[model samples]
Target: MVLGSAVPRRRLLLVALLAAVVLVVAGGVVATRLVGGPRTDRGATPVLTPGPSTPASPSTTPSPPPPPPGADITGPLNLLLVGVDTRVSVPGWEPHADAVLVLHVPRGLGRAYLFSLPRDLVVDIPAFPKAGYRGGRTKLTHAMSYGSRVPGRPKQPDTAQGYELLRSTVSGYTGLRIDAGAVLTFNGFDRLVDSLGGVDIYVDQRVVSRHRQPDGRHRASAPGGYTGPQMVYEKGRRHLTGWQALDYARQRYIPGGDYSRQRHQQQLIRALARKILDQGLARDPDQVQQVVDALGDTLVYAGGGRRLVEFAYALGGLPADRFVLVGLPGSSVGSGGSYRGEQLTTVGRRFLTELRAGRADAYLTKHPTLKVKT
Candidate 1:
């Protein structure tokens, strides 16, 4: 048993080392999404975040090369990327939430940073359309519930509106401005995952799957019955594909619960990012196109390709060691609420206040090496 356990750990260590290897080849495709949207012919909206003006990382390293001659001087930018699990069979896909992440890319930081926020974080969904009807303050995920039912071309509580409200609320709470955004449905994520040839993750425990009845509006499950198994893996690193990987990155019901799941998500993102940068995708156009094709109908970008490409190139210019990831401060707080009496948690306002001041580096500087685990 001891030898068996050690074997997995050794394997995981090896996988981690190859991490940088995958990053270079895959960097081209993933880097593009860091700031850019999909092809214009696809009818995606252009992202509106200010282009990097002056490099903001004057402290960690010299500012990134100045933007071209007339380059604008935008400061640090934040993005709230959401992953929804809505399939054709699951119509009335009520919650439309699978994962929620906050990506922070500071001017001149070069690399993209990601933070996964637990959906269970009980907080006020500010500007929620029902603010007048209900106190508006409720579980964060409910924001999608409210918008999906709103009638009209301009969905009342649509993702964009909810995102803005969320951005404002998170900013108000975290002191950051969410500049741009994107939404990928469950199908989109699956394809993207498959296209990237899956992501590697470390599983520390056993998990079992339970069957969930599809909403009937979305795609139907296989004849064998579409029950999702709870995954159980020994502590070690392994490559995961499609649904398996998704479930691994999304299991919030584990012993550690949402916090563990959030950490898992962050690690997945970082792992994916690193894999891309190390894979040298910039030199492989076919591979880059394949990854893009996988995104297909699932991706909804908020901006143009040129600007996005430029940003990706900029990120590729940065060294990996300088990249950092952090979460919203604070932990699970109050308890006893609606929805199964779920407990709520909120990050400290003061910490966020400092973050908004563009001094996250200050807090990070103090705690130089904070390793977050799933």
Candidate 2:
């Protein structure tokens, strides 16, 4: 009788364990579907499928090409973060990338580095088939403009085509094969900031708005038109709202001009990253969902939802301080009475070499001024 009772008890325990396993498996499925599921029109941003692939022979040696200038050598991931300013008033105006940043997340995923490319830097742009402008050397910002319109064709904005051309041009210039990319419109950026409950950043100096006039109109706006309220940021640490943060970053009339604006932009990135991690956004499912929704509205990635979620998860292990921001070393050059473009200095090339070798920290040690902090 004892042996029979023991056998029945064992069977009952086995059934209980199977039920638990099924529940666990079901839960996992639900979680993945909620967070990393396939793309949809409303939730999934349109993914840019990579161009044609070239298959290699089994006997071919599998070695990566030499790291390009400003390329990351430590890992496979190189992402381009573009901030585009779309002009609605101009009928045929294509959006231009106001800011371009290369985010290098190494294979180990311990830390990430961001390198900013100046918009005014002169570079060679290939002839775009759609735009009639037989492209030659021009400002880096013009690549997007040239790519947005088809030459001799009706005025239609092709942002996707523009992105591809810009990607190609950037890849050629940086010597890094851009594996993936994201474009964030200015409007989206503002909304993202607001969603995060604002970000805290340290303003190095008191920033007076050069774009705003005393009469409460933007310098660029029409005489009678309203450009919203003007903002003046005091020096030191401050919590900024979405519009305030955007205004702070858009200040080009400051002492350093565009370079200063670039630095401020980098600071904004750091502040946002730090804020997200500090607020436990990653740990909270509800918060994560909210952020994902916000991103869906503003952010477009080449890898779609899955890739974006995967990348976010990969960075979960990293602390806020692991993000490092560095500026490409360069100076302004010009001819005659007009202002010319900027060129990367010798130090910049050396900096790229160190970056490719995965020793940016060491490079920063040598040139402390290039290091940016929020």
Which number leads on TM-score?
2
Q: lDDT by residue for model 2 over 116-155, one digit each (tens)?
A: 8888888888877766667788778878778877655557
TM-score of each: 0.63, 0.71
Give Cα distance to truth, residue 314, candidate 1, Å: 3.4
What is the TM-score (0 to 1) of candidate 1? 0.63
TM-score of 2: 0.71
Model 1 deviation from the true structure expressed as Cα RMSD, one decimal place = 11.8
Off by over 4 Å in 2: 1-75, 130-133, 151-154, 211-220, 223-230, 279-300, 304-306
The whole-model lDDT of each prediction reads: 0.47, 0.60
- Give the winner by lDDT: 2
- In the range 254-365, model 1's lDDT, one tens digit per residue, is 6676666666667666666665556443333223223333444433334333333233334444455445556544355454652521332333343344456666667556
